[model samples]
Target: MKDTGWIAATEFVRHPSMVGSAFPASARMVRRMLAPLDWSNIKTLVEYGPGSGRFTFEMLRRMRPDAQLIAIETSQAFVAKLREQCDDPRLVVVEGSARDVRRHIAAETCGRADCILTGLPFSTLGDAEADIIMHETALALKPTAVLAAYQMRTAIGPLIDRNFAQVRRDFEWCNIPPCHLYWATGPFKAPKTARLHLISSR
Candidate 1:
């Protein structure tokens, strides 16, 4: 198991009532999700619900010096903590809900994003709220943009169908409880029906 420091940090940052864990993706997985991205064409990247800035820090590290990173987090405590933790001028930490993706980006970054890394737990969201957030996400994305979301839930067909042209599951069995990562492209046709392998732990 990874050290408890990371564990504690995540828990401290995530909303107390939130069902999802604050655990950040392993560095390897993070790199893989971002590898296909053409960094040269990417001037801005937005991260939704960046708990403790795990992926936020990583994105900052990998982006070109001219590139900027915007992390939209709703928790006030997490936002204050992150503000203290990160000092990079290229990084902008916004303490607000990602549901307002377009306004948040337009006000802070002043441009549409080339890549978006989301860590929200859609499984907990109501259908109406989910639809609104998803729609806003599409509006915020550049035509060629990619949105990579990490979900611990195996059943993401609804999300995949509603928002993506294609859905690829990059499974990491080594992680605790394991996880199913999703990569999606904007303006995708919703699938009629889809099946996925659901794993149950003893």
Candidate 2:
């Protein structure tokens, strides 16, 4: 089997539409994205666009022993690789789009997810597709559950604000091209109308 980096590059070359980034997320980026999460309360976690299982591995390492992780990937090759490499009974790798997060979670697990993480590039997706994914992700998460997503650009902030009750933005500079990390919580009765507040990481 080809190494993950090679596979990621090849996948990007072959299907840019499915695989958003040319490289897998760096370890630093993954850590920054998962930093504020409260692992004890997370029983069911869903990861969208888990390219090369970088974040998947990190989540499994720190998550509770009985916790379940559902990895939703659009790339068949990456999905196969995750199944082969991760080998954890708690991990469920599904080949699909983020737009069907609610369906995937319901089919794979008992209830809604406690958290959803993504490194998907919303800018590359069409407006309708992005909207569907954003709404579905919000629906899949339990009340007070968090959604953590990291992107190279900041364009998706407004869409996130529309879905979640509160949004907190942070920056991580350790990666090749740093990332904008958004940590959002809630599916409250009325979503917040506040703008994203950017905070610099120490």
Candidate 3:
């Protein structure tokens, strides 16, 4: 496996808005973010912003042999590098935006996802983009499906809370700039007017 630490660092320097973080998650933080999942039951998983595929490979390792993971990423460099480095039959690398998560999930699973995880920087994406991603995520999941996201702050928590009935917040101080990890479940269909109200209020 190729080491992506330097690749990720270069992308972060070139595009802070796109990369979200300066480094891939530490092994300890990755463990905590994933500890909430029932790995045995995750048949279809989706990951947003899988920079250099740090979390992608780990999830693929723990998933069932027949399970699939769809990794959606926006950075061209990361996407190309991931496709080059990963040969896992179960992994589908999509070069796209998380705002269109529903389409990506449908194209692969043809059903609801068992779990979705993200390292997206919602804080920099504005309320509207975050709302859209959250809403689309709900539409793409089965009931009680998990959405695990780590951000630099809790501002994204309210947006996530609006889409899911249950949301738990954890802090991982071992990471660069620290991280606010949210494990959310039981997605609710977002009201048609929710996004407009939230965006306009800000």
Q: Each model's TM-score?
A: 0.80, 0.91, 0.91
Better of 1 and 2 by lDDT: 2
lDDT of 2 by residue, 1-202 (tens): 8788888999989877657678778888888888899999999999999989889999999899999999999888888888889888999999988898888988987888899998888877877787778877887888979999998888679779788878899998887668899999886433333223322322
- What is candidate 1's CA lDDT for residue 66? 91
Q: Spell out the clash pairs found in candidate 2.
A: none
C-alpha lDDT values of all predictions: 0.71, 0.85, 0.86
Q: How accurate locally is residue 7 in candidate 3, as Cα lDDT from 0 to 100?
A: 80
Stretches of model 3 off by over 4 angstroms after superposition: 1-3, 192-202
Candidate 2 Cα outliers beyond 4 Å, as residue runs: 188-202
Q: How well does candidate 3 match the true structure in TM-score terms?
A: 0.91
| Order by TM-score, highest first | 3, 2, 1
Model 2, CA-based lDDT: 0.85
The TM-score obtained by model 1 is 0.80
After superposing candidate 1 on the true structure, give the runs of residues whose Cα lies further than 4 Å from its correct spot.
Answer: 1-19, 188-202
TM-score of 2: 0.91
Question: What lDDT tens digits, residue by residue, belong to model 3 across residues 1-202?
Answer: 4458778888889988767888888887888999889999999999999997778989988999999999999888888899999899999999999988888887887888999998988887777787788788888889968989888877787777677888898899998879999988888876436766888999
Answer with 2 or 3, whichever has the higher lDDT: 3
